[model samples]
Target: MCPSKVAEGGQRGWIVPIGGAEDKENDKRVLRRFLELCGGDGAEIAVIPTASRLNETGDRYEQIFGGMGARNVHVLDFDTRRDAHERNRVARIEQASGIFITGGNQLRLSTILGGTPVAQAIRACNAHGIPVGGTSAGAGILSEHMIAGGDSETETPRANGVRLAPGLGLTNRVVIDQHFRQRDRLGRLLAALAYNPFAIGLGVDEDTAAFIGPDNVVEVEGSGAVTVVDADGLQFSSMAQVDGDSPVCMLGVQLHILTAGASYNLVTRKASAGELSTVKE
Candidate 1:
């Protein structure tokens, strides 16, 4: 577990972004780690299953967190935008020490939670030192620019291969993609970076997570690795010169593969000493 510390601006929250397919039946390491960041057994957690279509999604997490010894676990479920705006429903988020977003369709999460009271409350919760965790589609929406959906095929980088949309914007200047190596989504993540070369693209593999502290320090966890694509120093790119469907050509796009226990500074765009290993082109 990462040692907790006071973040910049005096905030004490944590942003735990897990790739999809965490082990729920066995160790439950990811969820347990989230609980630890949220103050362990004394934490009040709110589980948001808005991204999932399954009816039992919320119940499953509620039971899991309860079993983990959370002081209180409330599942926030809403069908329509109006439901997201309900005062009573939004109040639950304000009182929680931690919030967990389940996996499903990321588009559904932005559509239902966007511009609503619940979304605003969540932002406020994170701002005031409350730990927030999400997996799969839940992890996808933790950025300012989210990958809504995209082609999973390993094709040449193209503009149309991936789609981008507004997310919860819990963190700006970053884009997150989940189920990375498990789904072979490197191509899609590359395509996304082609469109927005200035933003950092993170492709998190299954069972792995990027624990981002309030101070902008990210620590890798789980069995898999986190792929960091930094296109800010790109030497060349045909993204703007070519048509929408044309293949993109980018050079000098730095790539870093961060394994468990590795640390990266999001603000400096640099990895910790000896922890940084470049992915060869």
Candidate 2:
């Protein structure tokens, strides 16, 4: 079990970006680890499913969390920007032990909740020792720059293959892409980095997750692997000169494929395949 983020009393929390279609029926190790980090037992979990249009999406998570042993699990719905400001609604976010964002349309999450107090409150919680987690579109919006859409079929990087947008401003360290290998998104992800070599590119596969620790180490979990693209030594890029439809030219890019138990240091730009030990308190 992971140490309780809430009990840390101000030890900046973690950002959990889970690839889409996690196994909710089985062990659900990813979600289970998230719950453990949230403080378990009587943990108060808040589910945000605004990105999804399906009315049952939020409620379904509420039930899932409850069944998983969360004593207080509720779905928070802020229909519009105005609803985001409601004190009662914002309070729900502020007082939560854990925050979980469900999968859907990333654009909806950006347009509706981008600048609202609800977004601010969630940020506050994470900044003050509360674990925040998301899946799929939820994962996409957890980063500072999000991959809104791109060519999923292409295996080679193209100048116009990827689209970028502002996200929740959680971390500017990495740009997240979901269903990575399963959907063949390497080309688009590489293209995204070409636009800004400063930010690293993280490609998360289905049933997998990248648990970005406060210490800047991303611990991989689940069955699939997480691809880390480090463009730190990027010598040149054709982002400005290449045609929109042409293949991009680049130099000095590093990539790492990490499976369960492996970790990557965002700050050091290094990879480690060491096993991870459970945290106990």
Candidate 3:
């Protein structure tokens, strides 16, 4: 995994990627932690709800953040690519102490914010030690390589089982998959790894999150688990030999399942537990 870029005297913000369906009302362990990392009350938090089709998604999170003591909460919503250029909106992100992105179609988020000034601001926040968090599709957009979409019903390794798309590039070390176990996305997550073996595959379960620090250690939290796939030892892949979405053969892949309190070092490619499990890749 590539080391993340640094800023502000070699400091970087925490990148928190939450799987879909995080508990907003009850418990709210994951969201609350993100707020704490952002410096809690009075922090200027920016909520990006560009991915959702629903009009209320932005307001809903705005209320949530405000209710959680972020009196200075701003809901930055945009429709077309033109909206991304709004100087006032981009400035809010640039000055935000913390940023949260809501879940929806990841493609919409990428197409609208990718390469824009607003996206550039978000990256700056992270590099400057301001926490940037996202859930579901929001989580997918934080990585350099995002899982677009593909068949989720099966676990077979296929050349075309998953699609890849460019994301915000906040993190180049990992490819994210949300609502992982619930959606049976192991196949596609592994397929993404097969296609880009250089990047690690991170499959996060519902209500959970992976808080990756500048140190590249991911601290797992919330209910359910996080699946880490390391293709560093991959010996072979039949991607070139496959045709028409056919299942492909692969070898030497490692799998590690982690839960709350467990952590994984992205730099070392090692899980909290010493033993590394093998999948049928």
Tell me each candidate's TM-score. Answer: 0.91, 0.93, 0.94
For residues 211-265, write the lDDT of model 2, one tens digit per residue.
Answer: 9998879999999999999998999998899877899998889999999999999
What is the alpha-carbon lDDT for the whole of candidate 1? 0.84
- Among these predictions, the greatest lDDT belongs to 2
Better of 1 and 3 by lDDT: 3
TM-score of candidate 1 on Cα atoms, chains taken together = 0.91
Rank by lDDT, descending? 2, 3, 1
Model 3 lowest lDDT segment of ten: 272-281
Query: Where is model 2 more than 4 Å wrong at Cα?
Result: 1-9, 276-281
Indicate the residue-level lDDT of 155 in model 1: 40
Output the TM-score of candidate 2: 0.93
Q: How far is candidate 1 from the true structure (C-alpha RMSD, Å)?
A: 4.8
lDDT of 3 by residue, 54-158 (tens): 999989888887778875888999898889988999999988999999999999999998888888888877887889999999999998988889878677778
| lDDT tens digits, residue span 1-281, model 1 | 11233456668478788998987777787788899888889989999998999999999998898888899999999889999989888999999999999999888899999878888887778878898889999999887888988778564677677888988878876789999888888777888888768788888988888899887888888888888889889888777887667778988888889987788788899987344445455
